[model samples]
Target: MGKLTATSAKALTAPGRYSDGDGLELLIGRTGAKSWVVRVQKDGKRRDIGAGSFKKVSLAEARVKAVKIRSQIEAGIDPVAERRKARGIPSFREAAALVHAEQKKGWKNGKHTDQWINTLTAYAFPAFGDVSVAGIDAAAVRDVLAAIWLTKPETARRLRQRIRTVIDWSVGKGYREASLAWPVIDKALPKQRAKVKPHPSLPYSELLGFLFKLREKETMGRLALEALILTACRSAEVRGALWPEIDLEAKLWRIPAGRMKGGVDHTIPLCDASVAHFERMKAHKRENNDLVFPGTSKGKSLSDMTLTKLIRDMHAADLKAGGPGFMDPVQNKIATAHGFRSTFADWINEQTSFPREIREAALAHVNQNKVEAAYSRTAYLDKRRPMMEAWAAYCGGSTGGNVVQLVNKSA
Candidate 1:
């Protein structure tokens, strides 16, 4: 039987803990504030659970609530644990932090880890950070990603991936029953059209003239940019080149797996022009760093912006002279140092009889087909050597204007 009647619970004014019966109590404060609580014992330990305020929960209602809690205790379940589980559903922001903490160790570098969370913090947190992870649905995720889907497709794509990762982590931790966000959220986003502005690339016909002007400038920036074009390697790969990576006798530049984009070792056969250019750069090598293209400051690789700024300055100069300086015809933009890789690819496809696989291997592009990747162990260095040599001759004014159309009759 309960201790307090509805009439008595409201009439009491003193500040004290008073019991109703069957563990139900009326808690009164010194200021005469009133609330209901229930006391229960399980495993020789007593605990008090809040029922509600006396003003809102009547004695009859308190008894009903107490009865349910007692029933839970009798069934060997901790009511406190159940209550916490009910109240402690994680927010999206909290889950993201947990996911980051757990997964940061596996990431390649600190910058990548920061990028993973920074995107979520900037875009998704404001919209649904405080919302319960379990409560987050397709519409909520769509709302966050759709806003930037069109304007920042790259950012949106990364954000969507990180969000899905966080939600999947939540499900794995038993925080949510299912990850209802991904695949479905992908469909909700506006169909992103393929990007129109490819990296600006100079046409093969213009590359020789561009190389002449490029060679006129004598700086590490000029040499690095030239190496990038000649090898068709990524900026990082070219900028971070080490003295040990280059074997002048072998006429090869072997980039290790860690620095390469594909996470596989790549070998670039140095053309005569490219080899000579590297020899020139070797004279300017700093004592503190082995980078083939060291930054203006000692012991640092050339900044990515270094090459970009050089290209822009060249474009400005050409524009002043009323000449189109290494312009990408398709986009009407100044050709970038990175764009030279595409120029190389175009030269291969349009001018040479090299198989696409050989050309792609020269560019260090990974074969997407798993079986092909597994069986295609050879790098075909012997075949790529002649093509690179011809490319160098073309760049050095030894050839021009569809000079040698080595058409593959088999192809």
Candidate 2:
């Protein structure tokens, strides 16, 4: 018998794991999403199998499911795999969900992980989702690819790869006999050329001018955007920044390994200009919240669209004021917040005398070179300090309308 009653389960709103007897658990996420899991030891190996979402499965149902799971474990059968066997064969959607549940632990970026399944949900699911894994073949695969092949090339390409992952997983699980003729699908679909379109970013000469205009707005979004530009960090990093991650006395921002795009802990050497933004944020910090850029809600961070909307508004204002908006001359497009990183990179590559690695380190870019990465254990902190300082100084000084072109030179 379980310790949790329906009344107790419904009343639980706190974000943490709650245990019932017989190894059954009720998980509450930070966002208040609730789900159930049953822990069982099979062959001396422990496993936590998801019973169902709390919304879909009541406390009574979860207890029943937990009992079923434990009963199956006692029969020396794998509950999850046996459930699939009991169903005879999984649908493509079921197999995809199974693969995603197993694979998501290795994927660091939540956005990318969600995108992996979302693309399938959008394109592939409509056609083959309900089809049995055994029924999915070249024609079914080719049909899905053909619909979006020419229209959405990049999405189609990723969709193809994701489809193959699901089908390959099914084959490994013995649901299918062999691999689908991917080469056959390739022949059936039109060839797609990989296109490398660089993100639209400010001209190195115009970045300082753009920053000048950006500083006029003191909203949380703009302040965060300013910090993003000054520090050369990603939008997500700046938005999700917490008070604990920043140290004003030390003038450093330490992003934990899990939050980083590269899955490595990164310490940013803060400049005076970047530090000023944090100081302003600290002045108005909420008593119970730690977010450096908290959204309207107490604990939630700013939405992704907040920064993008700010860019659009500024561009519109500039046009109204008879000035060219913050446009990238090279790309002939309005710049994005993410594009600021590219501007920083272009400035370093085109104008500074810093060693290549120092620039890479400032941006927290993981070196792809295997031999160098194996030996380059140093974080290059001292080298990056001066480079970031120079970058901050370089941008802060340009508070004018005149475009001052910086040339390639040693500082």
| TM-score, one value per model | 0.50, 0.50
> For each candidate, what is the lDDT?
0.78, 0.81
1-411 per-residue lDDT for model 1 (tens digits): 566777777789999998878888898866687878788898898777777777788788888999999999999976655754687867889989988998776543456678888999999999988767765768878988899989998688668767887887888877765666355566777877776345888877788777777766456677778788878899899989999999888899999999999999999888777777677666766786788877766687888888888888877887788877767754457888788988888777656667888899998999999999899999999999988997776677222222122122100
TM-score (C-alpha, index-matched) for candidate 1:
0.50
lDDT of each residue in 1-411, candidate 2, tens digit only: 678989999999999999998889998976698989898886788767778889899988899999999998899876766665666889899989999999887544566678889999998899979867766768888999999888887688669878988988888998775667776677888755556456778866788778788766467777778788889999999999999999988999999999999999999988776777677676657778988887877688888788888898899899999998998643357899999999998778656667778888888899899899999988887788888888889888323232223222100
Residue 151 error for model 1, in Å?
22
- Measured with C-alpha atoms, the lDDT of residue 358 in candidate 1 is 89
Position 148, candidate 2: lDDT:
88
Q: Which stretches of candidate 2 lie over 4 Å from their true place?
A: 1-195, 397-411
Model 1 has a clash total of 2
Q: For every model in order, what is the number of clashing pairs? A: 2, 0
Q: Which candidate is the best by lDDT?
A: 2
Off by over 4 Å in 1: 1-192, 195-197, 397-411
| Superposition TM-score, candidate 2 onto the true structure | 0.50
